[model samples]
Target: MRRFCSVMLAGVIAGLGVGIGVKAHAQAAPLEVRVVVVTTFELGQDRGDMPGEFQHWVERYPLEQSFPAPGTEHGVLRYNAQDHVLGLVSGEGPSHMAAAITALALDPRFDLRHAYFILAGIAGVNPYKASLGSAAWARYVVNGGAAHLIDSREIPADWPDGFTPLQGHVPDEYPRPPLHSIAGDMAYQLRPSLVQWAYERTKAITLPDNAALQAHRHAYQDFPEALKPPHVMIGDTISSETYWLGARMNRWAERWVSYWTDHQGEMVTTAEEDIALCQALALQAKAGRVDAQRILILRTASNFDMPPTAITPATMLANAAHEENLPGLHAATDAAYRVASPIVRHLATDWARYKEHVP
Candidate 1:
């Protein structure tokens, strides 16, 4: 039914002035390959080092784009191996990152069965509970910087906690609490089942021969049980523009003005593109395109929000080099993969069996 529906939809789209290639995309029920890993930044250890790593890996997969394959601007490597089709898209920021994920998910040929969206980049943290290298997952991603203030005049007189009655309530500068979304629930809820599947499958399957895969496998098996439901806060928080201005300024409250000018917010957290991806996956799951249980989101922290003078190159370098920080990220990334991989394998196996029965 799904295949028939998609094929019909593709035909309709094609007939309506859409390109022929796109119309032919629905010939089959889209490939139900396992495990699509996405990274906003490069698959490298740091911001400056992602391109080389990205370039080296793209060599493994043949690309469909006209431009030169991976290593070039926004080059992609799409492939299917061991029943799992993987996509590697590079660069950062929300708009680009979101588009990349959507592209990978919507590509009818790839059959992206189960997706693991790993926001593999650095992030700013609370600095106290969250250190430089600690791996935090977002149970609740708060959209801090993107909120609009509801003016006192526009607000009703009886809304709970409404500021209309306050003495100093400025009509223009009303404060509003931030909005939050539960990001990792789709991913987090699957952890235990995934881990169980991992242990069961480890005995029968041969692990991948790739260096990153092997390292990832080892890291997955060793994941600490305490760190479930990883906290990933997505927002514009870090900037170098304020680095030089630290010492000259005495008043700290005014420092936010400089950062807001550049980064657009003081510091906030929200899911990168997980919300939209989750929505898409939910649709796919309902349509029986992918196993909902096999999906997960893994993210790594990069930095901490601090006074301008506090953040130095040396500080960032030290944070990056900090044993706890990098190891935690490596561990968390590995943990997520370790758990999700087998669940993906299980779903793929089931899908393959189902395909055999289709005839």
Candidate 2:
């Protein structure tokens, strides 16, 4: 009986040791991530009901794991463990985007050192460049909000508009001796090779079109590009917190992008969060938490930044306020997923090939 009791005690000790070892292993190693899909907002429940920028990814990729994401607009982050893909909603504006991205990057449960990030969302497209539902891969993301603004009525008659670059007395003035020395926060230039690769791969995709979209495009009869069917293109994005509209603002967006990129970028998509998102990612890259070169910004056209000739900007803005039934909303969301998913899948499935060298 004494021998039997001693053997039982020994067995219990061994089991306890194994349990502790497993727990320690789990605590020391974080989950490896391949790709992270970042979206701006969602309309309702993730699975059922109306779709937004995030719904298609969640339901289609079918992210099966839920991890608590404190301090984010959405309380939880979705994960597909099999594919090693994670989905995040950064809310609608710059503030929310900064907070959500920072929170995700700092989370202890994720290993993001080599993970690729894709910011896929909808934006107001420049009718002169692309039509509704078109997907654009941005090469440069310029901040339109970081400017010196004066009342249009009070500006000099010779000036183009009240907007000017920071520390500049006039519009479009080059502030520094070397243009490349401009503040890092003013703009983010993406890898041209990677941008070209993505654009080439997805440029031929045919985006969805309907009677409403057809009728809407017809209003922009003067703009040839707006009348064409939705397709993928390489364009730049301008981000501002204030949702400004009209022809004047459109022209400003074009000029802003040109000034920041030294005439290399053409503004196609206007959004509210990309600049802040980039800022956060850049900081994380500095901290050795992520790879900045692996970032990609994809925006689909949900609406036109300027109104048609027949309507005034005020009227168009008012109409857009009731965007739940907007015709381009669904098309843009679908296009974002269609255009971005191919790259995501390629990276996640062929991790061995792309883990060290970005393809």
Candidate 3:
């Protein structure tokens, strides 16, 4: 029965162009480091004021009426330098992120070698473990809601009571196969030499006093500029429309759901894009397409999916408002830009080895 269902699911995902298991060969020449940052909200006042740090690159490509498949309708920021080339797409979840990556990979312009993919955005954290303004560096991304209960569309009688067709299941144990944000094996491949290089580069960095840094004492004290250890990555796939229902399910589950509710005071269910993004990254690691040691996912925890005594539209709005404005949120965002730009810049500068690095 499970075998038959698996076949059907494969067909469905293929038809929808949703499953991203296949690899697309790069047509564009390879570059040093190919990095992709997927996010939601192209521009927003709450996140912080922006002279728009990536503006120069965006200006070079500018917005077109359209681009190409998967991303044909979306606005993409593309930049190509002698070092490396990158595409930054805005939008928060799995489908959008997968498509943008597909388009970029398939596009003749991008060189895929020695690539690093990053999903940077706001996330919901476990309240007890992290405060409002804390940042989490994901070591592995568990697909919290990737699996769904199967319902036979053809046989109405086969439908089980109390079960919604195609309804996603939230499992107790963290899902596997783990996506590698930091390629463990690959780090050793580039070890010693790369570590020495990194050491030399980081030796001069002066750690600035920041409130966000103070929050995660164990995580980032002496090495504010250094990449922190692996942390669990959970993507909020819950859409605004279904987030509440997801949150309620979270309450029943209690354990996993607390990560969401504790931050926002409500339940939000749905698979977030970063989860799948990280999953795809795991695939990349398996395929030997990217340098995992150089990759990292830096996210800010923003909402707690806890149910409130008095729930109202205004209350929900306030929760979201607070999530965005939280102290660590800005610090994480700023740190992401500050920390990531240099790596991207380094990859862009060294394009000669692009093909060898791209998976």
Task: List TM-score per model, in order.
Answer: 0.43, 0.92, 0.50
Task: Give the lowest summed-lDDT range of ten residues in model 3.
Answer: 182-191
**Model 2 regions more than 4 Å off:** 1-23, 26-28, 177-182
The Cα RMSD of model 1 versus the native structure comes to 13.4
Against the true structure, what is every candidate's RMSD? Answer: 13.4, 4.2, 15.8
In order, candidate lDDTs are 0.38, 0.89, 0.41
Instruction: Give the TM-score comparing model 1 with the true structure, all chains together.
Output: 0.43
- Model 1, 1-359: lDDT tens digits are 99798778777877898656864443665545555655444454322342322322233332222222333236654544654546455455445554555555556666645443333333433332333223333332222222233553666565322222122243223332222453322122323444243345443432123343233224223233212223322222222212221122212212332222332332221224444444455556676555555544433333333322334645545555432444244433333334334444454456645333321
Task: Summarize candidate 3's per-residue lDDT along 244-328 as a digit string, tens digits.
Answer: 3223444332333333233322222222555545444445556555445554454554443432334554555464554344434
Model 3: lDDT to the true structure: 0.41
Candidate 1, which segments miss by more than 4 Å at Cα? 1-30, 43-73, 83-85, 113-119, 150-294, 307-359
lDDT score for residue 2 of model 1: 91
* Candidates in descending TM-score order: 2, 3, 1
TM-score winner: 2
